[model samples]
Target: MWWFLICLAALIGGYFIYGSFIERIFGINEKRATPAYTQQDGVDYVPLPTSKVYLVQLLNIAGVGPIFGPIMGALYGPAALLWIVIGSIFAGAVHDYFSGMLSIRNNGASVPSITGKYLGNSPRHFMNVFAIILLVLVGVVFVSAPAGMLTNLINEQTSLHLGTGAMVVIIFAYYILATIVPVDKIIGRLYPVFGALLIFMSVGLMTAISFSGEHTIMPGFQFGDMFSNLNPHDMPLWPALFITIACGAISGFHATQSPLMARCMENEKNGRFVFYGAMIGEGIIALIWCTISLSFFDSVDGLADAVSHGGPGNVVYTSSFGLLGVFGGILAFLGVVILPITSGDTAFRSSRLILAEYFNLEQKTLKSRLMMAMPLFVIGGILTQVDFGIIWRYFGFANQSTAVIMLWTASAYLIRHQKLHWITSIPALFMTTVCISFILSSQTLGFGLPMQISTILGFIGSVAVLAYVIKVAGKHKNLSHSDKATDNLTRIT
Candidate 1:
């Protein structure tokens, strides 16, 4: 419990101390006009209040990843604590801050566009396709996750016999409506309510933990035993821990979502609060979930047994009821349900904006918005037929892979301006290693190589990539050269 409180403090402090420092490095300007004013598209680029943008961004990135991932990561025992705290402060918040602010600087450009601006056209084109695919994957995953849960909840809690198929159709319809509408119409209006549900759920559980003999219920962080791997399955801790705990610590998906709020931000000064502050909020949620999960089942082994029976979904259900009772648990269930649905809506919405930015298509017109949106839903609908496990396996690796690119892209932008580059560069190199090592070491994703060989070669590949990133950064060291290159590109509507 003490460990949990300390981590909570760190996440808050990270926003004021580290987040503000990153803002200064990026050089936020109050005088400059944002795309919400400059672009002035009624659908995607409409201006929103800072408080609303913060809540929208929070709901956008706070998908099931924060809750489910941390619960799963908690299976590794106390080892997950360090990654959630340190990674959120240094790596995750920094990555999110730049991904949004860079887009704001470039007139609300998508992740692929911003990456292309700094990295190169090759990465730009690759990311253009890659980001759309990743967003589609998110849409499919979030749809299925919540729909299935709703099916069960409705059937058991009410007289309604809702099937997963029916629930999926309902969610899919809501997603399509949310995707094509104006920025403030569906998403901006509803997300604050959803955000409140999320926080209320977390607070209820926290209050329950406090009254339930917390020290005996939750283990304190220990220096000696903390860093040790406690996975019941004895999985390798390095890449697995980092990958399992994405979004809570750091997620590439946040980069995709950041631009959505970036277009709505009225001022550059709000970037840290909306982007970095949201990431910290997510970390706090992750920390709470991780602590509650570890303690609720009496032991890590017991938690593993529950997970084995029903996966992380089971962990969420059983733990909520055990800790919060029947009435509170039902409300908690609604909060959990909202997690994926909110993300699913924005996942498709971000894809529409990304395709619009990439193709230079205007989103203000109904036809133009539908042209980008319909095909994404079609692709996502087709993928609903694919196995969930296969999609999930790729989502984890791809999520981090995108993070590596965004970090290096931000690093290059810093180098061009001759500002502090290592803030992003170091994390970029580290995540590059994590992504490479994770893929090579996993049997389904890679060659099923042994850990010994994978670790050694992953480092080698990451170092080689780092050297190339440096070379590219060096080419843009003259701010005039980089500025000229940016000025030449077409701005996205």
Candidate 2:
């Protein structure tokens, strides 16, 4: 319990100390005019108060990933807790900080566009396809997850037998409206309310856990215990846990989502609050879910059995219902229906912006916005029919893969200016190895290769990528005017 409290404090302190350090390294310039004003489309590039943008950014990236991802990761035991704390402080927050700040630096460019500018055209094109597919997967997964929870909630409460398909349609309708409308219309208005629910849900669940008479499966924390692989399914701890317990840790999905809030930010100084602070908030949420999942189930095996039986959604619903009672049921609705819906809308919204950038179409017109959003909905509509569990697995791989790209991109940005590139460079290399090993391990996201061979290959791949990143950074390129405007970039508030 003491260790858990310490980890919680670490996450909060990371925001004040580490977040500020990253902000300084990036050289935030409050003097530069942001896209919200310079290119205020009132649609996508509309400016908002920093507090409002923080809430919007929190909901946009929070979704259900912080909940479901960590819940699934709890099957691996307390290691998930450590990952949520450590990864968020060192990697996740850094990834998100750069994702938004770099976009702000580049006229609110999307992830692919910024990556292309720093890493060259190959990655830009790869990220174009990669980010789009990941966003669609996130959209489809969020759509189906909430729809499933809603389906169960409705069936249990009323005699209504609404299927997941019906709920998906309702969600899709909302997504289309959220995607095509101006930034202030649907998302901006409701995000603060939704973000509040997300935090309250976690805190409510934590209070329930603390007062429960049930025997918790949680073991006393030891320094070495966090790294032990306790997964019942024999999954490797190195890459699989890192990949499974995403979003709360370090997610590439956040990178794509960051640019959405980037365009809405009123100043560069707000980047730390809206981007890095939101990730730390998610880490807290993920930690709560992971802790309660372990406590409520009584054993890691029991949690795994529950997961194997009905998936993460079932685990979330059961724990919420058992611990919090009738009110728990209501929060379950919010967890399944509201949280994911908030993220789903922004997922599609970001996709619309990215597709517009792909086609070089100005998003100033309603017609152009619709043109970009239509295809994402069609693809999401088709994919929602394909099980949420499978979609989530694929999304995790793509999510982390995208994070690696964003990390490397940030490293390139820092290295190009010769301003302490190691902060991002180290994480980029570590995640690059994780991604490499994950895709080749033949276990979860990889091919049918032996673990030893997969690990060796991952090492080789990381080295090659490291060499390439250094070479790219070494090119005699000029930092953008925004990167040089304020060298101190110091503001505590």
Q: Total clashing residue pairs per candidate?
A: 0, 1
Query: Any residue pairs clashing in model 2, and if so which?
Result: 252-403
lDDT of 1 by residue, 222-267 (tens): 6665778888898888888898899899999999999998899998
Candidate achieving the largest lDDT: 1
Computed on alpha carbons, the lDDT of every model, listed in order, comes to: 0.86, 0.84
lDDT for position 71 in model 1: 88
| Residue-wise C-alpha lDDT for candidate 2, range 144-230, written one tens digit per residue | 888888888878878888777778888899889888888888778888877887777778878777867774436544567677877
Residue pairs in collision within model 1:
none
TM-score for model 1?
A: 0.96
Return the TM-score for each candidate structure. Answer: 0.96, 0.95
- Best model per TM-score: 1
